[model samples]
Target: MSSFDYNSSMIKAAFFDLDETLINAEHAHKAATEKAFAVFGYDYSEERKKSPNHISMGKRVYDNLKARRDGAGISEEQMPMDKLLDIREGYFLSFMKDEIVLLEGAREILEVMKRKHIITAIVSSGTKKYVELVMDIFKLRNDIHFIITGDDVERGKPDPECYLKAYDQALNELKDLHNQECIVFEDTESGITAGKKAGMRVVYIPTSTSVPPINYLPDYTIGSLLSFKTEVLI
Candidate 1:
């Protein structure tokens, strides 16, 4: 983690990315994709997943599988996107009870934010169902003031649309809050880019699934949320 400091007192709102950022679900996602492919007598490899052609994370299961089909020369008629998504969702749900878990310091930070009366929201590209599931498992619904899911936005991350929407809502909730007074916590290149583009300070926390070699840098980078201290902001 860097020694960079934050003016926490000035930060009235906080936005967080889901998935690898809040919970350990990346591997479960990978496993679900692989299992879905196997059902159709296809294989998904690490090399292909790491390739530039791989679809970006945080996209709908349908979009990700569609990209995979396109790359594999499989037509939509041969392997329906909806069917693939259904299979993937089933596997993903099965893993949720055991494979997926809250990351270290996740609860502590949320508690700190709540205790300090800071507005907290989840700005994620995940669907409402999945996001709600995570909130239910971790019992975070009360801590989060609002949620902006992929369903709420026409565009996904790396595009500022989602974060911009969140910024607008945050501004509405807090009378004097500005974009700069909002901080975003992210674990992926796309998420970090979205936050910066939305004019919010970003805290980048790398995860196992985070794609590297990003063209841009975040305002702050930390190894994990465990290293984050809200006291500095006070």
Candidate 2:
């Protein structure tokens, strides 16, 4: 067997991805997407719902509407930006209300991290309102130290903006802590990439849908957050 070098540095702060990572709410997102698509008089099928490409389903629907507006032989008039916004908001609100559920071991892991005095935060591609709603519904509002949502940055996950913002928040909250001591917990490939690019160690926990295969491995990977023992931090 080959010997491997392990980094002995202890983590001081922890950032988590909100959707599908700490909360299993992709189904809510899918339901919202389907409802949004219906506003354009397009019905999404169960087959489309089951497709792996459903991760980009929202963007696809938006693009389709824009394409229709461009005409170029298509008869539909240009959809007002405000109308599109309404459709998106309506669908999200309809699906997210009382539908958010925390993943198994999520609350326990967060409690454990808090007990260890780790600064905990949420960094997500989701809108701040949505993230806040989920946190409130799941009773995690008082547990986390901060949240960096999509509206806080110009770009989303896989861009590093959100994670970097989250790190800044953590740094401010933990004034004496070094940036390298921060760790991120993610369930999606985009989130993991962003965390790593932000110079943070990442712990990946896969969800049932949308999470890409790990082409670039995270600092740690486990089936559940409960498997993350305190010894790993020490």
Candidate 3:
């Protein structure tokens, strides 16, 4: 656990997870996966779809497709991961503009961070194109100082690489900011673990009850971003 004094130090920067945290895109993601599986003549199990694994919660679409293919005993020679990923991404991006909705208090929190002059970045397992599309559609480009996507990192959530990279970039861009001064807003256990491992405070906001039990504890758990107050971190 980090020894960050949340009560004393002002939050200098904020990092957010893209999909379920900032926007309600869970259903859209699932639909895209199912569509991709169908195209490849694979049966995406209902049980697997309903049961979200905490370990794979914040992983990339490619990783998820690989896992599914492996589980179904399919080989890359038959169904290439890159091809599967392309299909999945195509389905996801096609209707994501209409299917994605800003989560409650998402804009409010970003606005508060912006008004306070705090650096904000989106650290996501989504691809650069997907994340950029969401930002463009929601007009979040100006609000977000930077973004670190799956395309930008070798490892995804639960590995701390993405968040660490974001924090490192933030340190270079902003003065008087430490990793401990950054608060990560996340909706999945893997994201929380990644943030905590990066030595930052994490606020977990679970988007689904079906999500598996978290392996690591977060600094705070809130129902939604609506309850988040930048001034009163403690």
Candidate 4:
């Protein structure tokens, strides 16, 4: 029931993380990984169910493929980085088509933010294409003010680059607003860390399962986006 007054002219923008925060796409990631594994004739269902710390699933898959190629004595000339990227992109697209789903209150929360005229943007560790797919699925492309994806930054979440990029984008979009006026909504530990590191007030929304322990507690924590209210906007 905690609330904050947002009527003050100071607060202006709200930054959000996509996966697990604004959109429930972890399931999609797993499905994508499984499909990607299938392309290599490897089944990952057993590992997928038991593992909760596979944040860099795409990179992991790429590394696995690289290791296999090396073991087979494939020349470096044969396995170019572009080819690897293409394979990952193909698998991710397949996963998006088959398994992406938005979290239950995402549309409502976003609508409320828009009604309030709060500048909103998505800052996610996911690739640009994957994030866009989810946004399209949720019909949230136009609703969001901006987006900062993995491809936009040199470092991903937990490093502050993504949030910084989003903050910069928001500042450009909401030119009248100051940096301190922005806030962030996140679910994963890395996402929260990134937001906090960027000096924005953060609200944590834990997922139903696989809630990672946050090293730095967020300004606030909620069980779901459904619990977010205007009172907490400050």
| Candidate 2 residue-wise lDDT, 32-126, digit = tens | 75676567665554425333452442122344334333432323453464576568767776777666678888999888888888888988767
Deviating ranges (above 4 Å) for candidate 4: 1-10, 46-85, 232-234
Sort the predicted structures by lDDT, highest score first: 3, 1, 2, 4
For candidate 1, list the clashing residue pairs, or say none.
8-233
Show where candidate 2 strays beyond 4 Å.
Answer: 1-7, 46-82, 210-215
lDDT by residue (tens digit), candidate 4, 183-221 = 888876767777788888788887665456458668767
How good is model 3 by TM-score? 0.90
Root-mean-square deviation of each candidate, in angstroms?
2.5, 4.6, 3.0, 4.6
TM-score of each: 0.88, 0.81, 0.90, 0.78
- Model 3: residues >4 Å from true position, as ranges? 1-6, 46-52, 210-214
The local lDDT score (0 to 100) that residue 93 gets in candidate 2 is: 68
Residues 1-234, model 3: lDDT tens digits = 223334667778899998888998877888888888888776676535543465356787667667667766677887888888888888989879778999999999988888888889999999999899999999999899999999998877788999999988998878667888889988777788899999998887877642633577787777788877566442
Which candidate achieves the best TM-score against the true structure?
3
Estimate candidate 1's RMSD in Å.
2.5
Which wins on TM-score, candidate 3 or candidate 4?
3
lDDT values for all models: 0.79, 0.69, 0.81, 0.68
Task: Report model 4's TM-score to 2 decimal places.
Answer: 0.78
